[model samples]
Every structure is written in structure tokens, then in C-alpha cells.
Target: MEQQIDSLFNWLDETTSIIEQEENTPYIEALIAASNLLFEQQVPEDLEPNYRTQLTNQVNAIQFSDFEREARQKAMQLAILKGMKGATQQHHYITPETIGVFIGYLITKFVGGQNSYRLFDPASGSGNLLLTILNQQQNMEVDSYGSEVDPTLIRLAFNNTNLQEREIEYFHQDSLKPILLEPVDVIASDLPVGYYPDDDTASSYELKAEEGHSFAHHLFIEQSIKYTKEAGYLFFVVPSFLFESEQKDQLQSYLKEHVHIVGVLELPKSMFQNEKFSRSILILQKKGPQTRDPRKVMLAQLPSFKDVEATNNVITQIDQWFKNDR
Candidate 1:
């Protein structure tokens, strides 16, 4: 049974090596040790841990490993990882693993035409956004392009998103800085919500920053729309004000000249309030001749952001909106 378990769990060894090269292995290594220790500690000292077969003592220590015990261990390990990985190395951190998966699923679903494509995350904090895109792209080459103003965050994002050894372009500059690069198909971003440090607080030692906005919707909205090519999509998660604010009409007008306001999934503001909602993914497709017949806008939002399960339902409904309504 010990040999059998070793064989079965050997994949963890391979996974460890893979992540190690990317430098994401330390967390996993620590997790394995912790998992082993916690599981062992849970067992009663007096009774010998039973092997896979209670009938025989042929098994080694983990011979006592049961589905519940093993699964519980894995769950704890995963929970720890989730917590540790939750904080973004970059400023204005927002994306989480679950949210990343959700975004990846959508991007993967959309990008089926090209053999490969450049992925642009205007606000690529810790590369979670790009990683999510990579997972969804299957084996397709993802030419990642993202910018971070914070130098430390640029390093962290680059290190964190060590993408299958794929060549990537990471910039350590303000994402809002104008660039002369050619247009890309997808521009997905999660903008920052708060204000930057004011110059007054700085003794000239710290980098001076600007004032805060009631909403970052306009800023990123304008940038993404301008940068994206006609017919390419700009996916964003912004404050709830992006939806149906009085200014929304003006924002829509601006988009009309450049792109179509195709989809708006206004998530509950409170979704991230419990450290959850993250507002919502507002899907906007640039207008072009070949743009789909389903040019009408689709709105997916909750009355409020409080209930997470409802927000999840909103996610499912958003998926359904693309399929059923599209």
C-alpha cells in the first residue's frame, strides 16, 4: 500500500519540479510538509495508523490515509495557498484565483479563431490576469503584454506569472502611459479603485501620486477603447457606477464612435466588499464591419453585491447571457 500510494502521489513530485523552475514551488513544498504534519498529528498516538487495508499492517505511516483525511489535508493545503496567493504583489490588487478562473473560462471561450494571440492586461498586477488567460488558451501561444507602474510589482508580476516558460513583455510603468504599440484583440483589465498618495505627504523621497476618482470607469474605459482594434474586445471589471450612471449615457456615446457597448455584467458592489464582488466584468467589443449580428447590449447585474451565492448565480447567468442571448 505504501508503494501504491507513492506511485499515485508521485505526480506531486513532477508538479513540484514544474513550479520550482517558475519559482512558484516554495509554497507548494511548504504546503506538502504542512499537509504531512497536520495529517500525521491528527492520528491517535496509541493506535498504529492502519494501511489501506485494515486487515493488514503491510502499509507504512500514511497507510492510515483515508479519503476524508487525504482530502482534508489537500483542502487545508489549498486553503493556505489561496490565502498566501490572495495578496497581489502589485498595487491595487484585486484578482483572486476563483475570479481568475472565471475570467479565464470566458476568454478561452471567446478566442477560438486565431492560432495564437497577444494577451494584454493593462493593469497586470502579479500577473494573475495573464495567468488566467494562459490557462484558458490551452496550448496556444499567449504573447503576454502587461504594464505595472510599481517597480516591485513589475518584478512580482513577472515572477508570479512565470508562464510555461513563454516569452512575455512586462513593463514597469504606469499602465495609463500612452504607447505606440499596435492594437491587440483582447484587452482585459481590473482598474484600481482608490486614490494615490498625495504629493504633500511626500518629503520628495516617495513618488508623488495623483488624486482619486469617484470611479475609474471613465479613465480605463477611454484608454481601452482607444487602444483596442475595431472589433476587438475590451473586458474590464470596474466600479458599479460604470453601469447606468447618468454619465453612462455619455460614456456609451464615446464608445459608439469607437466600439460597441456589447455586454455589461454589473456585479454587486459588495461582491468584493466581503473581499468578494470585485464589481463586475463589463464586456465591451470594439465596433467593426465584421462585428457579430448580436450587437445589442447585454446587462448582467444584481440588485446588490451582498449575497455571494447570488453573485455566483449572476456569473452563471452572465455565461448564459453569452450563450442564450448571443
Candidate 2:
């Protein structure tokens, strides 16, 4: 599998380099290369004839169908990670595969047995995390949707899912703005953290700041909650200081009114470069006639993922809690 992923990534890198010679940025080159890989044809008519021919020859050498879905996804992830390295934006980070798999496991715990359910990721960057979750739920039917504001990322996302042969409805716009989506059974996001720039849009949110710009992460939480069905679950990768900031009181009040806190699992500290930058997975269930608060909110400090036995033990405990408590 590793070799397969490497081969696919090498092809992407080479193709991207070829496209880069046309004076495009690494990000654009990668997106173009990936799209060409997905369609198994060169889509750019504007490329120099020589570069176009080289890309065509490279594309013809590999059978994309020969790679497993996981291999293809991982290869694309590598290509995107490389592209992001050259990007100027600080928030172009891709979710680590381990974290994506962890979130996918949690989602499966709640909805795996259902016949079908709708899932949405409002901050689905490059569709990596959302696709990771979808890969885990292959046994069941899922209506998946992802919204991303970045044009480059959304195009990469479309190409990624298309190559994986997974169907997802995508919305390209500010997720904090009014979305025309029906409430979903589950909402998951590695919430974008920062102050929202648009005061007009921020004014409409319950978590909007009274004196200044609202925290984008705070507004994302509210927006996600608004698009979640009653009794549905929300899993967010939230900053460690989420409830310790100046606006904690208002955010807490809003959460208390709309949802029941189900769990807060602190991710392994080793996963982050600094303690202050670490995040936790916040689990909440939207209040509904059928929903009740758990006897105790699930809380745990997860061990380093490298400690396989410890990680497995924690997962077992989580499974037992879900089976016997909720």
C-alpha cells in the first residue's frame, strides 16, 4: 500500500512540476495535475503543446483504477500537503490522518447501525476529513455534504472525491452565511478559529461579539448547530481555550440553551507542537424530545497515538460507555 501511494504521489509531483513550468503556483499546479489525474485526460488547453504532451504520456502510464481507494486518497493527501507547504495562508493545514480516522471511528459509533443518515462538514478543507469519515461508513448509506469557502480547496475536494468514486454535494461559500441545506443528522468540523471579518454577518449569530468581531470558531459552532437535526450529534475539533476566553460566558449560555454536552475528549498532547495550540473533540447532542443528557459527560485525556495498547484501551472504554451508559 505504501508503495502504491508513493507511485501515485510521484506521478502527481512530476505532473505538477511539469505544470509549474507554465508559471503557475504550486497550489494551482497541484490542483490542475490532480484534476487531470481524476479525469484521466489533460483538461488545460492553454498549456504549451510540449508540456501537454508530457502530462498526457505521464497520465497514460498509470491506471488509476489499479489503486485501492485508501491508496488513492492517501496519495492525494500527500500531493495536497506538498501544495499547502508552498501556500502563503497559515490556515491551509490538512487534518492529520490519525485524527481523521479517530473522528471517523466516533461517527461510526453513533450512526453505523442506522440504515441511512445525512452528514455535513461546514469547514471541509480539501474534503480529506469528510472523505476519511465516509470511508469508514462504507457499510451504510450516507448523504454527505461539504461546504468550503476557498476556491482552490473546493476544486481539489471535488477532484479528490471524484477519484475516490464517492458522491458528495458541495457548497462553495462562506459557511457562516445562510446555507440552503436541510438540517443534517450529524455535523463535524475541525472548526476554523479566528475573528470573523464581516460584522454584518456576525451580527446575526447568537455567539456574535457584543463589542467587536465574533470568533469564527464560535460562529461556526452556532452555524453547525443551526443546521443539525434535533437529537443529532455535533463533533468539533475545538481549540483548548475554547471555554476559557473572554466570551466563554456567552458561548456557554448559547450551548446550554440549544444542546446537551455529551463528551469532551482531549486529544493527545503530543499531537500538537504546543499545549496552548492543542485541541479537543467536543461532542454535543441537539436537544429534542427523544434526547436526554448522559448520566455523566464523557471526559478523558487520550494517550499518545503511538501508544497502541493505551489507545486501544481508551477506545474499548469509549465503546463500553456508549453501549451501557448512553
Candidate 3:
């Protein structure tokens, strides 16, 4: 609508005013450009609206999506054929509202009725996942913890939480040997996609001061079991290759032996088409004291252009499962 555009224009002008007040003209310009790309076009009602939003870097600098949400939406829609590339790839993934919708639905449905939940994220990339929890649960208090190795990324995560007025306890530590021992009910992470480790450079680890362990990915998963409570659940994004790779047979076997695979969300290759490797989200349940549902194996195929409202739609699905008459 013409009126809608004018309102958006006005809002952006106000935002630019703030940027100008701060003397960040260049940054403001970039934001203005990116905002246009996100809102310039209309998305299908059935599909989530995608946009290129500001993601503050660790250095407290702004990072813009090279391509606007328009590109992201197309890439997502044609994700199977066209992988992520260019601007969309360089940008830190996620939007403010989508993150909240997904996790808010999860918390309200699965973890809500309890007195409280001990929440954790081993690989809290940019604190996107953590921010969702804080935004959704404004009233109740939960014990929160996170483990991120990159100091810069960790610093950004911490600062973002504070900027949002979120209450959480985060630490700069190896995802594998996370220091926190607080009992956790739900553990989630957008881990170092197998293709991209925390640093993305094996040599960087050698170049850095700290000595390291091999197979950081597996080590982290193995340790996730250790850090989690008996009935606790873990939701993670791992490469699809993990499912059939014989190299991970033991890890998979170990999981089946000691834990439970509640479901495997076979993701679209589009999830990380821009990257070298394919990706998927795996939901695991710690084999402990919590009630188990043998009849169900929950799975979700995350669509590209994941808008918050569309993200909330998934919650409606989850609610049916959790609210079912047992």
C-alpha cells in the first residue's frame, strides 16, 4: 500500500535521524538501503517474509546483508536449486522476531508448566537462540547459560543480550567442555555447521595461544550428553552427512545406547545452500527420567525466509503434539 510505504519511509527517516545524531551517516545509509530491499517487495502469504536486518558485529560495528531479504527469499524458495551465495552468505543468519516465535512456542508448549527450566546453548552463535528465549519469557525466570569459544562472537552475544535487557549467564568456553553444571531442561544450538568450525580455520587454532582437541564437533556432542540432565532435551543443527557417515557410527551408536533420538528434522539443502556442506536440524532426548513418547518422532523441515510469524506457525504444530491427550 502507498500508505504503508510512507509509514515505512517515515520510520526509516526517524532511524536515520538517530544515526545522523550519532554521526554514523555511512552506516545509516547502508541500513536505509538494506531496509528497502527487505520491504520493497511483497512475499507470498503462505511463505515467511524475509529481510536483511542489521546484525551488530563483535567489535560493536554494523554488518549489512550484501543482498537484501528479497535475495534471501528467492534463494530460499529456489533453495533446492540455487544455494546461498554472496550477500546472504556473509550476513549473520536470523531475524529478531522469527527467533522469538520459534523458541517462544517451544517454551510455552513443552517447558512452560514446570516451576522453571534450566536452559543452555553450547554453541550460541551470536546469541540468536538465547535472545529468543529472553524475548519470549519476560515474566518467568529461568537459569540460563551458554558456551561460545570466540571471544569476539561471545562479546557480541553478551552485549546483544544486555542491549535487549535480557537476563542470561554466558561464558566464553569451548562448546565441548562447557563449564556450566546447572541442570538443564532444554539445550539448543546452531552449532558450527560441520563445514565451518567456530574459527573456520584449523590453522587459526594452531596460530592461537590455546592447545586444542581433535574432532571438536564430536567432542561437543559427546559433552552435550554429559552436561545435560537425564530427562533433558537437545536440539542442534548438524550436517546431514552425519546420519549415514560411518565415521560417526560410534557417535551415533553411543547416542542410541545412552540417549534417544526423538526425531531428525531433514532440512532442505537450501538451509545452507550457500555453504560448502549441506545442513539439517537434529532433536535428541537425553535418556533419563523424563517421560518419553514412543509413538512419535518429531521432524521439521525449516523453510528459507523464515519470518517470525511463519516461525510461530511451527509452534502451533508443536502445541498439538505436546497438548495431545496422553
Query: Top lDDT: which candidate number?
Result: 2
* Local accuracy of candidate 1 as per-residue lDDT tens digits, 1-326: 44443442443333333334443455444334323333333322443334212212222333323433223323332333443565453343546555565567667667766787766887776566666566567777777788777654565455344312335688777555575567788888887754434333222211122233323446556666667877787788776655456455656566667666666665545445553334777777778887864535677655453466876787687677667766
Tens-place lDDT per residue, model 3, 1-326, is 34433443344344444444444454324333323333333222432222112221111222123333223322222211111123333223433334334545555555556767788888775566676665566556777888777664565556445434457788787655437476578887765643334444433322221334334555557667778888777777676777665446656667777677776655545555465466666777788666565467767765553455755666566566655621
lDDT of each: 0.56, 0.88, 0.53
Winner on lDDT between 2 and 3 is 2
TM-score per prediction, in order, is: 0.60, 0.96, 0.60
Model 2: per-residue Cα lDDT over 151-194, one tens digit each: 88888888889889999999999999999999999998999888
Q: Rate residue 139 of model 1 by lDDT.
A: 72
Instruction: Find the candidate with the highest TM-score and give its number.
Output: 2
Which residue pairs clash within candidate 2?
none
| Superposition TM-score, candidate 3 onto the true structure | 0.60
Ordering by TM-score: 2, 3, 1
**Which window of ten consecutive residues has the lowest lDDT sum in model 3?**
51-60
